[model samples]
Target: MPSMHRKRNKSLGLLELIAIALGGMIGGGIFSVLGISVSMVGVFTPIAFVLGGLLALLAAYSYVKLALYYRDEGATYSFYKKTFPKSRLVASIVGWWVTFGYISTLALYAYTFASYAISGFEFANSEIARKAVAGLIIFIFTLINVWSVKGMGKIEDLMVYTKLIILVIISFVLINNSNTTIPKILHNHEDINILSIVIVASLTFVAYEGFQLVINAVKEMENPRKNIPRAIYSSIFITTLVYAIISIGAILAIPFENIIQNQEYALASGAGEVLGNIGAELVIIGALLATSSAISGTLFGSSRLISVIANDGYFPKFLTKRKNNIPVYSIITMAILTFCLILSGNLVVILEFGSVTFLLVSLLMAYTNFKIRKHTHSSLIVTLLSAIGLMSGTVAILYFEAITKVEQVYYIGGLYIILTIFAFIFSYKRN
Candidate 1:
């Protein structure tokens, strides 16, 4: 077999690839979703975390096959375009939706970062202060990404590993301080059903969305076929364990209402109660590190994706400009859009949008993999099951929106329509 290694001026190794995925996955996702998951299903939040990991694994199956087959830095858009070259519409839809998906997540991570960063201050919950801080962090990371990818990767490694250690320690401390056990909590709560767990698990899919960041870094990585799957799977598994442990600790130690009330910074607040100022401070530090790296990683990989799409002519050609192999304009564009979203300051809606977009995109990816399963040597049954899993996630989100926030469903629907229109216009112009 020919070596899959590609000689380049610089390359990222298996560890770095894993860092990118972990950095992306561990961002505001856990911080933001922990409270909601716990509220929806108290003692079983850890179970939901494991189920979420399973769903992520299923999604990664198709992404790994497509990444190996195409080896295109474009990732989602590139995979779909190459798979169905004749359909400009398909390319356009995937391109716009996926790019915007990253943008929404960027906004999310920054917002979550702001929440934690300001949590120590008297004005922590102040909306204006939070948005201002969020915008600042986004600008700071955009500059860091523009400076260099290697530099960004190093920072990501430092932050990701450090936070993982902090998270594990905090989990242990919280669990030890708890007066209750999982069995006690479970036995006391009889109303929690399997269906509720499944629903929350589906919602947890957003937490696992970052594994694909590895694929987006194909151009910078060594032996992608081996490293891509290794990095993605390993990161997801590690993340699952981290999430499960911490979530169990939080649920066990803190009252459910406290978690729900301080949903944005639940862990930190709960830790304060369980372990006093030191414990709260420790969780805050972990969150700050987690969200910080996430913002950096998302900007680093997604900017490259934007450049790839622009170069393909689906987006403005001027966005293809690069300096020292950096997509400066693309990075700026993403940062500005993300800042705007932060200014809007609709956390739940933004979270729902990001999760829904990725779920739909993953579903499409599964179908694409199934279409060329023979060439990719993919398992027919697994690909089909992946589609089903992704579909169930989409359904779960839509159902939640319909019952609690019907207006958000309409808002998301309207945004999709607008995105589809832009995709069609650009794709048609390519002719």
Candidate 2:
């Protein structure tokens, strides 16, 4: 008779890391941002996206350095713990907040998918049907995640490819239509300012959030030290180029005022103007896939967060159960919560709340980078500059919204703060 010990799964290879990075970065942001960014920056929207991409690259560099040096699964939480060992509670808070941020983002994307899907059908136009469809979409993706991580990964790969193809096709079509003039919308505008550009850039930056999801799967990466950084930078470069082209095409096709007034599906409308009805339809389908993929990837990554918290004894042990290596219970829980959020039909509010929390997490990550530089002798100059860029960009966005959309900002922030406090108390009591 012989006994054998089971071996744990190893690190992810370069291709797998690229898959994860592409899956994360090519989601709802590109699908949804054209109209909004154009409204804010006019024909300069493409420039704004490029500027945001630069900042995202800096953040990605910081994340890669942290992941390689620390070589742990906690991502930002791990960085914070190592840098601020004396403030473990703060690290825990940041970790919990990041989990909440991702979950909220998942809910937002689910709601967006539902809204778009419903719009495509007669049922979505109806209030009740819209909510029902939204819930159904959320639940279905949740189940997909619960069933198997491998299955979810395959789905994300397909989605990333589809999105990339669609973006390329649209870019080609728009560029081919050289007759389209770059509308001089900015010439007449009085609102062009640094603050406005920063706010728009921040919004554009959010589209790049998925790059870090690759790092979360670092343990699953083969030679994460080598492969992960390449994937992160490569994905960012490709996505940034795609986004800039799309934004430019959109502004060139449609006038700025029209985009502002028609904020819903602005990018698709612009594509239609450039490529006719067929191009617009393709863009819509692409947007649907983009939102669906974002929700799917968010569910996949967010469930891991819950699994981590449970493994740490911060949540019920049942939540940590991995059926076929997937956290079934946590996935189902997140799906249910996401379903409820979709039912509320408040995607914008959910997005704002998610952005606020995520920005806070980024702030903490920046601080962590600052602290860890002393230990690793990593480039302190780049780290500090990145932190400043992130914080300033986040504040600029928040400030813009606070001035013009004060009520929405207050409501979303207040709700997130309340939820954060309650979650903290619950975790502390359980401990």
In model 1, the clashing pairs are none
Distance from true location, Cα of 225 in model 1, Å: 2.0
lDDT of 2 by residue, 208-324 (tens): 777777766654556666777788899889888888887766666665665666455565656667677788788777777877777777777667767776676555679889886
Residue by residue across 46-128, what tens digits does model 1's lDDT show? 99989989999999999999999999888888888999999898889999999888888888888888888888789988999
* Winning candidate number (lDDT): 1
Clash count, one per candidate: 0, 7
TM-scores of the candidates are: 0.97, 0.90
User: Candidate 1 — what's its lDDT?
Assistant: 0.87
- For each candidate in turn, give its C-alpha RMSD to the true structure in angstroms: 2.2, 3.0
